[model samples]
Target: MKSKDNFEAVLFDCDGVLVDSEPLTLGTLRDMLAEHGWSMPLAECTRLFLGRMVRSQSALIEAHTGQPLTDAWMHAFYARRDAALHAHLQAMPGALAAVQAAHAATSGRIACASGADRGKVELQLHKVSLMPWFEGRIFSGHELPASKPAPDVYLAAAAHLQRAPERCLVIEDTTVGVTAGKAAGATVWALCSQGDADAQHALRECGADAVFGSMLELPGLLTPPR
Candidate 1:
């Protein structure tokens, strides 16, 4: 009884969409960058790194600090970030309900595709008790040839789900993630948890097919096939 509104699979992004880990992640990164002489406000740090891998910003970091981005520095960042998230991370509001609805609607065909390191993604999901829903289906862009703003991770998740990208629904929170989902040919829906009109507009302009505030709205939006 599949209908136009139903998708064969539902793919989700990890940070802002499933767990409220962005602030912690960006905050840790901001403090670390300050130690390296690249201090900036939290908002500026977020604008620079949201939906992007820290390693991917090596050139920018080098440019600002006159120092190479080293593995030791990255490990330190990961260690601090993971500790913070393990202590304070929580699932986004209604995230479990949204995930449940997607799982049921697609008969368990769902995955988490994120532009983060595997360890970070797994740790956050585990801390928030969301690991079971994704488990082996978690796809990390850091493990692929390219990350978000590229189609690699979403495409990989869709392939693992044994579904065509066109038949998948990608739920993302950032414009970078939306672009990746759209590039993968999925129907991209953005979760604008902040309820910011500018974010909604930016997501749409970045190729999101739809944008809505609150994860609670997702279950209704993903209407079951009649």
Candidate 2:
């Protein structure tokens, strides 16, 4: 909404995009799965569940185990993983600075649209001092009828923020996140910090408008002069 900025709003995805919690999340899932008659490697878990919701994850697990995962089992998995993330989640490198830069440049028109539940988003944002930047503007994928790789969260966020989908720029760190952003008709900028040229190339194939290695590059990319 800034007179000078080009985009109407910046939509952010929380986990790898905001916090350095993807490793923690994947690690916890791997351990929890190992306890449940399967042992998923960290790599596989990241590939399957990064930027996805609990229900999608349960589907993967059920497919892997060849049996339906009970509601009780699914809830317990989330409970254990949630406890682990609550204890030690850190913001991504330059996350606070990038958030501040975005708001300063755009007149506070940034919002979060993540596959995480509301409680998890709140906790992670507060832990890293990014809460004030988003506050009431956070949109959870859990709030939608479907989560990412679907566009529901991003579309809902743009609606809530009073912006058109095309006028919002989405920041994400996974293919699922990128797909969701693009599906919502927003330009997606993927942060593929964990990958090399080949990996970043794959991200581009997933529909990232641009790809960068760190959060330090985020604010500049989101607010290029018109």
Candidate 3:
């Protein structure tokens, strides 16, 4: 286990952590797929695409349907989804508070390590008023060689934070993210926004240092040991 006091920076995953946008985005993707005559259940769609980038999801769709999902199709889907997301999105419970608290404690070293493209992540954060909190502290996996379940994204965030991997704490909501944090040598705290006890257990098994039901509990959960 990582020593609690070892961490000097906090890295957050954006989608399900900073904002409750997963269901909305997933729904939009499902709708887009349906328009092309490819029907997919919400749960199944989420299972396949939840921590992946839009480009990767498009590839997966192409692979599954044996039909090309062109860049134009992805661009159209993202444009529509971004508009809806901007209109309807809100922060997850305690998300802003947690970010504030972590920033105060870490002296402004809180960073976002998201699988989202840089432009879209920045826009969403800006829309929700979380942009300033992460100013100059965002790391997009799209810029890295690999995404979650790989250590690149988290490592990049840690590097940008000027903190050692073992001295970074990652706040994440998915099993793949927990795995990636651990692989990057960071202690990971899993948030149970997905409401799946099985998934929470899987996160623990995959190496989350702790799990919390909501970000409201994260301050206490992240307190350093004396």
> Highest TM-score, which number?
1
Model 2: per-residue Cα lDDT over 134-215, one tens digit each:
9899999888899899999999999988889998888898888899999999988889886688878878998988888999
- lDDT tens per residue, model 3, 142-167: 88899887999999989888899898
Worst 10 residues of 3 by lDDT: 1-10
Off by over 4 Å in 1: 1-4, 224-226
Minimum summed lDDT over a 10-residue window in model 2 is located at 1-10
Looking at model 1, which ten-residue stretch has the lowest summed lDDT? 1-10
> Judged by lDDT relative to the true structure, which candidate is superior, 1 or 3?
1
User: Whole-model lDDT, candidate 2?
Assistant: 0.83
Ranking by TM-score: 1, 3, 2
- Would you list the C-alpha lDDT of every candidate in the order shown? 0.92, 0.83, 0.85
Better of 1 and 2 by lDDT: 1
| Model 2 root-mean-square deviation | 2.8
| lDDT over C-alpha atoms for residue 169 of model 3 | 88
Taking the tens digit of each residue's C-alpha lDDT, what string does model 1 give over 1-226?
1235679999999999999999999999999999989899999999989999888889999999999999999999999999999889999999999999999999999999999989989998898889999989999999999999999999999999999999999999998999999999999988888888888889999998888888988888888645
> Which candidate achieves the best lDDT against the true structure?
1
